[model samples]
Target: MILLDEAARHLKASLKDMDTVVLTPRLSQVYAGINGHADLLVHKLDDSTLAVAAECTDFFKNLGLHYNVMPIEGIASPYPGHVQLNIAVFGKWVIHNMKVTPEPVRAFYERQGYHFIHVAQGYTKCNLVVGRRSLITSDVGIYRTLKDIAPILLVESEHVALKGFNYGFLGGASGLINDTLVFAGSLERHPSYARIVKFLDRQGESWTQLQGPLVDVGTLIQI
Candidate 1:
């Protein structure tokens, strides 16, 4: 079965074997108040322990994911919810490259055995991994850092959606399932559409687009 968040519910029937989860509206409101993005409130730390806002505790439990409630330390809290816990786990390292990250979150990945790579882009999930050592991102800083390390296709960020914001992140706009990279919307309108298709083709990965506007739904993890 495919696991998706409520924002993607419109694609449910089309996506075979679908299972969906929705975070409480209160959490959505809080996220909007901060970064205007829900991804800032959720993270799949690993197979277990899906880190999410406290309000989603029961929702995740019902989905059978071991929920780790992220404490809301207010907007000015030490941690920048927009980037602090929003890390990308790929290749050899958990690529965050941010100057500061919560120690507890950092420690969690350390125990998982991934070294942290310094990249200026805090929105790691926006850089979707098409294969084992390949990714697609619109973040130039991340592209420059991992270019020599992996096959990364740098794209423009104009078409992605962030709702109240100007644009959303690419990594957060799509997810990798068993053999296909699923995008929340079609890529025909993206400037990098052709390049993205070519990159995915070279990586031996297929992609599917759901019908709708391309919105960032956070990273979908298999629980």
Candidate 2:
């Protein structure tokens, strides 16, 4: 009732485990069936972490990650309990050097089962951390919230929308190397974005049919 009303009210909630279980029944079944298909040991990486001597997700990818890395995961939304914190980096702190972030951030990730390990860089590195051998995530925006980082502002590269999580971060790029941890969202909601719709009428990975596209679960998520 609430979800239907929200949709009718023009407000979609940020997805959660509850949403996953409720909405994507097939995906849940798929995950359950593939749960024993070799655990995917993964990692998250970025330039700031590289400069700071912290290992990036590329390191894990080159080592052959247990699973494929999807760079963008969640959608970007305002950080909680703030009026204008999400875009603050653009106006004022884009180039400023900061010694520390709000304490709530560290606490937030810690609550998400992430073990904080500070990287020591000759006093010129941003604070960052990695996952604890489980769900690999470093997006501070959606660390505990449903909001992923904005995808439009990411570095130029071809990106794919993974089937499971949208509003989250993945570590590596498609070819050059592992993608950096960045906020990625609004891939499907964009008019210019087109992905490989592999399904019934949508024959190949890349095709366009004005009539009607595949409406299966996978196609629904990507196209």
Cα error, candidate 1, residue 18 (Å): 4.3
* Candidate with the greatest TM-score versus the true structure: 1
What is the C-alpha local distance difference test score of each model? 0.63, 0.20
TM-score of each: 0.79, 0.18
Candidate 2 per-residue lDDT over residues 124-221, each given as its tens digit: 11111111111111333322321232111111122323334342112211101011111123333423234311121132122222111111111111
Model 1: residues >4 Å from true position, as ranges?
1-8, 16-38, 66-79, 127-133
| lDDT for 23 (candidate 1) | 36
What value of lDDT does candidate 1 attain over all alpha carbons? 0.63
RMSD of 1: 3.4
TM-score of candidate 2 relative to the true fold = 0.18
Looking at model 2, residue 75 earns an lDDT score of: 15
* Candidate 1: tens digits of C-alpha lDDT, residues 1-223: 3445555556556565534433323354344433423455556676656665555555556655445555533222334444555667775577774565666667777787877778876667655544554688888888888888777899987677756667777787777666567787778878888998888888777778877677676654434
